[model samples]
Target: MLPAPSSERWKPLRAGLVDMFYYDQEEFWFHDGRLLLRGNNGTGKSKVLALTLPFLLDGDLAPHRVEPDGDRQKRMEWNLLLGGKHPSPERLGYTWLEFGRRAADGSEEFRTIGCGLKAVAGRGIARHWFFITSQRPGAELRLLPDSRVPLTREKLREEIGSRGFVYDRAADYRRAVDEHLFGLGAHRYEALVNLLIQLRQPQLSKKPDEKLLSRALTEALPPLSPGLVTTVAEAFRGLDEERDALRSLADAQQAATDFLGHYRRYAKVAAKRKAAGPRLTQSRYEQLGRDLAAAEEAFTAAQQQLDEARGELTALEEQRAELEARRDALRADPAMRDAERLEQLRQDAERKEKAARDREDDRDRQASQVRKYDGRAGQAAHQAGTARDKLAEALREAADASADARCAQQHRTALA
Candidate 1:
C-alpha cells in the first residue's frame, strides 16, 4: 500500500517591541507561538503589529531606528533578516495574511512584510504563513505555495488561463516559502484544496455522478444462473405480449376518453345554442312586432289629431260666416230708409257696423295669439329634443371614462 502523504505545518516565531519613533513605537515581537502584544489602550499594541509587517512578509528582523538628523537626511538604517538569513536592503518577500480588529474602536489592526531570501545552500526554500485574529473565534492556516514567476509570455498566458498557478512575483515567493515549510512538491495541492472548498461551499458547480449510480445499481443485483436467465428471458417475452395487450387497451381507453370529452364539449355547445337560438329569434320578432304596432298607433293618433284640428278650423269659419250674415241683414233693413228715422237708423247702423268690425278684429287678434303660442310650443319641443341628445352624449362619455378607468386599473394590477 502507498504511504499516507505528509501534511503541512506552520510554526510561529518571536514577536514584540524593538524601539520607538515619532508617534510610532520602534518594534515589538509576538512570536513566542502565542502572539503576545502589550501596550496601553491606543498605545500602539496594534501599531507594533503593523511595524512587524516586514518581518511577517519576509520573515526578517529589522531594528526600529529613529531619524536622529533634524534635516531628515541620513539616519540609522534598520537591518532585517528572515529565517536567520539576512534580507537584501532593496527587496523583500511579501506576506499575505488577514488582520485582527481593535476591541475598543472596532478598527482593523494587523501587518504584513514583503521580503525575498535566497538559500545559502543553493537549494530552493519553502515558506510558511498563517493568520491570527481576535475578532474571529479561532485561527486559520493558509496553505498555499509561493507564487511562481513565468518564464515567457506563453507561460504567462498558460498560468493566466489555468488560474490555479500563481502569477505575481511576490505571491510566487511567498508560495515558495510555504512549499518549503510544508514539504510540498510540484503537485497542485492549492488547486485541490480550492476545489474541495468550492465543493463544500454552497455553489452551482456540483454535478450528478451517473457512472456511480450505474455502478451502485449493478452492484445491488444478484448473480444470474444460465437456467434463471433463460427463464427470465421467456418470462420477459410473455410480459411483452401482455404489455402489448395492455397498451392496446390503454389506447382504446384513451380514445374513448378523448371521444367523450369532445362529445361533452359539443353537446354543451349544442345545448346552449338550442336554448338560446329560438329565444333570441322570438325576442327579435316580438320586438319588431311591438315596434310596428307602436308606429301604427302613433300614426293613427297623429291622423286623429289632424282631423280634430281641421274640424275646429271649420267650426270657427262657420261661426265667422254666420256673424257676417247677421251684420249684412242689419245693414239692409227697410226702417233705415225713413227721413228722420233714416238718420237715427244710419247712426245706429254705423254703431252696429263698428261693433261688428271690433268683434271681427278681436277674433283675428285671438287667432294671431294662438299662432304665436303654437310657434313657441314648437321651439320648446325642439329644445327638449336637443337636450335629450346632449344627455345621451354625456352618458356615453361617462361610460367611456368608466371603461378607461377600469382598463387602467386592470393594467396597474397586471404590472403589480
Candidate 2:
C-alpha cells in the first residue's frame, strides 16, 4: 500500500476522479441519473425489486424474502444462474460504472471502474477481478474523452495480479468495488441498501421486511398490548445489536484492507511479548526452551575461558616477581663490585710506578756530577804540592847566603 504523503511529498498514489467521461469507445451515453430500461410489467420490475439488485449489491438472499420450497430457489442461486447463462463459460459476468472524480482544487475530473467475475475451474465459487492500476485493460475501461485527441496504448499492464489476500477466495470483483467505488460497511453500502429498500412504495412492493429487522422496526410503533409492545421493543433492540456486531466484524476484517491491508496480518501471533498487541503462538514452547539451553551453554564456556585466563595471569605475575628479585641480587653481587674496584687499583699502581722511574733517573745524574768534582779535587792537590817545593828551595838559598856573610865577617875580623 502507498503510504500517506507529506508537504514536500504530496503526490497521492491513487488520485480521485475529476468528472464522468460520458464518452466510451463508441459514443456518448449518459447525461445525468436518467437511465431508461425498456421492459414489460411481468418481465423484471418485480425481480429487480425482489431479487436482482440485492444479489448484485449485497450478495444476499434474505431468508424472509424466500418462499417455502420454491423449485427455482432450491435448484440454484438466482445470481449464479444468471452468470451461467452468459455467452462465455469462463466469464461469469462483467459490470462497469463511470463516476466523476474530485480534483486537487475541488474541480471535477473523470474516472471509470470496471470489474469482471470468472467461475473457479471446478468449484461453484466465482473469483472477482481487481483493477490495480490505470493501465491497459484499465485504460480500455477508463478513458479521458476528448473528440480531437486520439487514444494511444503505450505504457500499461494487460491485466491485474493473480491473487491478493490469497486466503480471501471471495468474488474478488466485488472487493474492488467495495474498496474503491462503494464499500460494504454500515456507513457506506448497508446504509445505502436500506435507503434503496425504503424507496419501494409499500403499496406496490411485495416481500415487505425482507430482513426481520425491517418489520422489527415497525412492530414497536402504533397502539398495542403492553406485553406485546415490550416483546417487539426487545426484538428490535436485539436485531440492532446483531447488525452492529456484524458491521463491526466487517470493519475489523475486510473494510480496513486499503488502510491496514489483509485480515491475516491482524490474526498473527506476536514474536515478542514487549510488542503491543497481536497475541502469541501456542505450539513453540519446547523449541524456545532448547534455544535458552544453548544460550546458557555458550555463556558457561565463556565464563570458563575467563577463569583460565585469570589463573595463567596469576602464575605469570609470580614468575615475574621471582625474576625481578634475581636481577636485583645480581646487581648487588661481590664480583661486580670487585671488578670496578680492581679497575681503580690498576690506574693508581700505574701512576706510582711512573713516579718511581723518574726518581731513579734523577739519582743517576747526581752520581755523574759527583765523579766530575772528584777529578778536579785531584788536580788541585798536585798543584799545592809543587808550590810547597818552590818555597823550600828559596829558604835554602837565603840560608846559604847568610852563612857566607858570617864567614867574610870572620875573615875581616882576622885581618883587623
Candidate 3:
C-alpha cells in the first residue's frame, strides 16, 4: 500500500488516521523502521506522529501524551471535531499502527493496534476504545467502510469480532499491547514509555544536558526483580570456581592455537599436494549432491501438489455423487408427483370456476333483456285500454247528441 516499507524486518510497517484531525484517511509509511514528517508550521506533522507513534501503543489520549510539548490546551476531542471546524456535532475517528515481522521462512505476521475516539461538541471525548488485531487495514480490514465514513466503536467491534479484542479501559489496552507487542510487563512498559517521552522532548535536540539526561535515563530503567537479584547473587557465589575453570580452559585454548599455527604450515603443503588429485572428483560429487537435493525438493513439491489435486478431485466427485443422489431421490419422491397432480387439478378447477362465472353473467344479461320486453308489453296494454275508454265516451256522446237533436227539433217546431 504505501510503497511497502523497506523489505528489512520492521515492527512498525505504517501508521494511519481515519477521520482523525484534518485527515479523512491518511497513511504514513515507514522507511527502514523510521518515518519522517515534513511540512510548514501548524501543518500537524508533530500531531500526526504524536497520535500514532507512542500514543497508539500507550492508549493514553491525555494532552501530555498526545502533544510532544505537553500542551494542556490541545485535546483529543479537538483533533476529532477540529474545535468546531467540523460541521458534525459528534465525530468518530481512528489512529492505528501496523506492526509486521517476517519469519525465517519468509512468512509474514502482522499485528495492528488502534484506538477509536468518539468526540462530541462541548463534551470533550465521549468515549475511547482500543483494539489489537492481526488483521491489516486496507487489506484484510478497512477502518472506513466508505470513502468518507469512519467506523463507529460498535461497528469496529463487529468487524474485528472473534479475530481480536476491543478494550474500553486504557489500562487493559496498555497491558494487552505491552504483552502482545513488546512482551513487557506493566512496570517495564511504563519505564519504556517514560524513556521514549524523554527522548522525544523537543528541547533535547537543541540543548543537550549530560547530567539531566543521565538522570532521566536512570529513572526510566525498570528495577530488577527479586528473583533475578537472587539468581545473580547465587551465580556470584560460584564465580571463583568458574574463574579457575575459565583459566584452565584459556590455557588449553592457547596451547591448541599454538599447535595449530605450526601444523597449518605443514598441512597446507601436504593438502595442496593431495587435494589436486581428488579436486575434480570432489567438485563432481558436490554438484551431484546439489542436483539430487534439488530433484528431491522438486519431487516433494510435486507430490504435495498431486496430493492436493487428488484431494480436490475426490471432494468434487463426492459432491457430484451426492448431488446426483439428491436429484434421484427428488425425482423418485411420491410427494413431488402428488404435488404436481394437485397443481394440475387446481388449475382445472380454476378454469371450470371461471366458465361457471361466465355462464352466470350470460344468464343475468338475458334476464335483464326479458325484464325490458315485459315492461314494454305492459306500456302497450295501458295505451290500448286508454284508447278503448276514449272510443266508448265518443259513442255515448254521439247517442246523447242524437237524443238532444230530437228534443231540439221538437222544441224548434214548437218555437216556429
Which is the leading candidate under lDDT? 3
Residue-level lDDT of model 2, residues 134-217, one tens digit each, is 232234433333432222122112222231211122245345445544444434555554444444434324544555446534
Better of 2 and 3 by lDDT: 3
Q: Model 2's lDDT to the true fold?
A: 0.39
Tens-digit lDDT track for model 3 on 1-416? 11222334547888999998899899999886788889999999988978886788677788887788878899889988888999999999999999888756687878889999899998999988999887899977899886668888888888888778899998999888876777668887988887887677677667898887887687668788999999999899789779999999999999999999999998888656554434433344445445555545554554455455455545545655665575566557576568666576456545644554554454455445445544554544454455455544544443444343344344335325
Which residue segments of model 2 deviate by more than 4 Å?
Answer: 1-30, 41-91, 102-115, 119-126, 129-139, 142-188, 194-416
Evaluate all candidate structures by whole-model CA lDDT and list the values in order.
Answer: 0.42, 0.39, 0.74
**TM-scores of all models?**
0.22, 0.28, 0.51
Better of 1 and 2 by TM-score: 2
For residue 145, model 1's alpha carbon misses the true position, in angstroms, by: 83
Q: For candidate 3, which ten residues in a row score worst on lDDT? A: 1-10
Clashes of each: 40, 11, 0
Off by over 4 Å in 3: 1-10, 222-416
